[model samples]
Target chain A: MSTLEITDLHVSVNTEDGPKPILNGVTLTIKDGETHAIMGPNGSGKSTLAYSIAGHPKYTVTGGTVTLDGEDVLAMSVDERARAGLFLAMQYPVEVPGVSVSNFLRTAKTAIDGESPKLRTWVKDVNNALQALDLDPTFASRSVNEGFSGGEKKRHEIAQLELLDPKVAVLDETDSGLDIDALKIVSEGVNRFASKGNKGVLLITHYTRVLRYIKPDFVHVFVAGRIAEQGGAELADQLEAEGYDKYTSALR
Target chain B: MTVTDVARESVASALEQAPVVSHLNPLPSYDLADHPVPTGREEVWRFTPIKRLRGILDGEPSDARLEWDTSVPEGIEISTITAEQARELGELPPNERPAALAVARSGGAALIDVPAELAPGEPLVIRLTGASVDDLVWGHLVFRIGNHADVTIVLLHSGSARYCATTSFLVGDGARVNVVSLQDWADDAVHLGRDAIRVGRDASVKHTSVSFGGDVVRMHANVEYAAPGGEAELLGLYFADAGQHLEHRLFADHNQPRTKSNVAYKGALQGQGAHTVWIGNVLIRKVAEGIETYEENRNLVLTDGCQADSVPNLEIETGEIAGAGHASATARLDDEQLFYLRSRGVSDVEARRLVLHGFFNDLIRKVGVPSLEGRLTQTVEVELAKTVLAGVPLGASLILPVEEVAD
Candidate 1:
């Protein structure tokens, strides 16, 4: 079992003007088998928290402590964090023009596992994962996210999540651009991953619709670079009805 | 004035009023005296570092010998013929000094002839290995493809010597030919070569040049149609490492109506002093109506301190052509690509390697030689390894100062 603990995490990003603080004293803890949903309005630091945990170069951790089962996650490099069983489903998945999906997946797997996977079973596993996400087996030969649709991109992330099987997944707005059918497909994929019973899910989203499919054990209402309130899944429903107005006004 | 006289006068005036726009000068002569030695000021020799040419432009001759081998399939003829005998087949006029010198010095030429209506089962292979020599070596070669014949020729160069050569092709009516000329010389070798091809009626020719080694290698390939319904495709691939100079210049003269030409060249440069030059010129003459032509060049800079020069020129004497266009681009690795790969757990080095491979993959596939594909891929991998180590570190560090990020 793995536990992710983020305490007093202060992150800032450099802009044209100067260093701008994005996440101000945000703290959260997620243990194995728990799903925590972070909902917020635009520019409320939800994605910042996700990128910070994944060690994106753009976000500087000014003052924070992030640990994975007592291991110092903040001290690790981006790839090291990934090898330590942390994954980030980016909001905007990048397009790599010439690298095929199969090659990228295999290379990532090899890097994470510290050895090359057996080719015979690996190909089968990749095909099965792609099929599970409603992606064509031929998609493996296509360049990584080069010309994929929004729904396809989200589904590919879920497929990767299932195949990589990280201990913790910080999904940043994976359901934002998905339609109803795509939302269901992606939610089911995430739910299947959660059902594994040994992973932690930190789902970042702006709407409560995805929460309807993949129930969150904990819901945090984020405002002004910090979590203003936290409660059980009922809090998501309350925010759904009331919206972020209450939190934003209270912060003001 | 009479009606006929008035009509003729108007037509003559209209023809006189039309502006004459020349895209390229007329083809130079093969006689050494007809062309003056270049002082590097001429447009054709401006990009070349002429001083390093070791006086070859001044008609310098070397006593060095090159080891030659040919592997031909049955029914194909190969023989060595004196320069006098070669002239009987056809007159191959040189357009530049190196070509003129090569023709003047080469006592004999290696001739490869394919019979009419015969399709070769396999590609004919020619291997020319240069011994380590300081003297300048000159060579001349001729390829004659018979009517309706189809063949592929592979010319491989290796080892070390200062060399200059000219290769000519005579494509018969309705014939199809593909020629791959690879320049993989030693680090100290300097090579200058010219390829002149004459495409006959309804014939198709594809010429590909691949350059990887040599301190200084410059190749000029020109194509002209002997009759209408001819086609030519010129493709080039080059990689220049530190202190190496590799240049490829191409000209396609559309002198016959209904002919077609296409030119594409791609290159990669890395390390300090690594330079590459690509010049593509296409001229559509007034009589060459209903012709189509396009040229494109792209370069990838793997590190700082390397230069890539690409020039595409199109000169149309008449506005009646079907289509004419050209494009060129030189760029470094995309930062977003590197970030995307790194975010997926690929190390910086591995990510760069993948990007370089992808950049060259499409061009390499166009060669279509199955036997050489694997070796070329491995060669690129090895080249990347050597240059990747000495270049600017791949993928910027995450830690950024206030000043650094602001800019």
Candidate 2:
């Protein structure tokens, strides 16, 4: 029913030396009901790609066509893109003070659906999703992402993904700062969203540990701002066993 | 240039005995009871309009009255004091001087004290009204809160007579008090007020007030955290409609270690020739190490002819504290915040309310009383409705669903 497509995408950041490229000529597409894993080394522009696709104002999309279900995603505002069913499970989400997690999720859900959720159903849905991630119900009242531990913050991102139920999600290193237990819980939350069939996930990460839980149908290796290799789940195994030496040399 | 010249001229003038004329002594000798007129040259009065003082010699005397038929809310005790009784209290211990000024100036003033350690209750309403009498008049009140006491005093001053008011507050250690002083005077009435506050150790005093509908208002509030670990939160919300001018000046001093002070004052100016000025100075002494101080003054200019002037200064001698910051911004309605709200199905007027409510929410919620919060929300919403919804089709039957817009 829906798909997220990034074609010849290039990203950059403004620096003292003028705009410097981060993501270069990386093209990827994930149809609805598909799961795609993007593995890459640090500084390979994986997170940049995720933020750029989500329309983060801080990231500049220098060259690309990012569209969702034929809609020009790159032209949409941050909230507009989000409301269009695009979700980003940030590696390190910003801590928005005075905004509670439940409140944020409810607002996002309302914005995406263009209607208010049933209050009775919302409470139950939020509680169940939080429980699945081992989060305390009391966290609903706390400020969004504020004062949360590394593991708790990661779990919160997943909880948002589960509750908002976006049509497409960009998981940017969701397991980076997470421990083994938190990684499993986060992976489980991701798998739950994928099981919904209409949701597409672009899981970006460096390590292969999270792959053990949520097996990706396609894994793409990113190097020097572009995808260098594409294969099945065995690609994760090969990278984990042999490392990214060949891709690094090719990027050089 | 000196007060002696003004006093001499007044004493020598045939108009000296005129019904409205009040004796003016040398500047240094003028009792605090005698209202002081600014020459418009004084540093503190630089931003203030000088003409507001011209009516002092001709305005009708005030015969103000205190009307509270609804009775003071439970937990708060109120009593009146005569000028003679206050004078008997003498200079009042320097420590209690702030609260004593009100008693000293009262023809009949009210005294309010909340019991210690009692659960906070509904806000206490203190409504001061003045008859449309001929001449300048003065009223005063003294307020004291006991240890761990919590209360909100709504002081509303309104009338046609020229009114001068003085209120003094003493917050005991560990006490928490929120005071909302609203001044809405007649178009021709000149309202002058001075407030002095002394916060005890570990105590907190919050003062939020709005000045509107007044011809000319000059208000001064001086706060001092004289004991270690004391804290004070000061918020000023004022809106000057067409042809109105409101000036607010504040002085917050931190003389004890570990004391904290925060000031957030915002004003909206609209219509032709509406002018507002805010001058705030916060001093953190060297001896007041570990003290934290922050001040912010923001203004919203809603019309082309409206003007707002703000100067927030912080004098910090030591940096031993955890944090100290100050921010002041003056501009028209934020188009960004407005558009963001409007896109969410809120009409333009409702969108403005959301933005303005968000602007003041940081301070209103700090009042710590839900009922009072609701009341102030109504007050601000009404004022905003008058400005933003003016000439619009919104009727009394139109109720825009506010919902949970805070997040």
Q: Candidate 2's residue-wise lDDT over A81-189, tens digit each?
A: 6677888887776654445566566766776678889999999999999999999999998766679998898898888888778889889899898888888888989
Candidate 2, superposed: residue stretches over 4 Å from native: A10-22, A59-63, B1-36, B39-41, B47-70, B74-84, B87-120, B128-138, B144-151, B157-164, B170-176, B182-192, B199-206, B209-219, B224-362, B378-407
Q: Tell me, by DockQ, which candidate is best.
A: 1
Candidate 2, residues B1-407, lDDT tens digits: the string is 68997886655454333322211111212143343444666575576565764455232344545444434766677777665543343212211121233333445655666767654556777666666634466666677677888777778777765666667687788988888787776777777677768788899888876787578887877677748988888888888888888988777766678888888888887778889988777766556788888888888777678788887777665567756778888987655444333322334565455456656665567656576667667767767776676634323222221111101
RMSD for all candidates, in order, please: 4.3, 9.8
Classify candidate 2 by CAPRI docking class: incorrect
TM-score of chain B of 1: 0.90
What's the CA error at residue B379 for candidate 1, in Å?
1.0
Give the poorly placed runs of model 1, Cα more than 4 Å off.
A238-252, B1-26, B80-93, B200-203, B227-231, B255-262, B284-294, B316-327, B389-407
State candidate 2's TM-score.
0.72
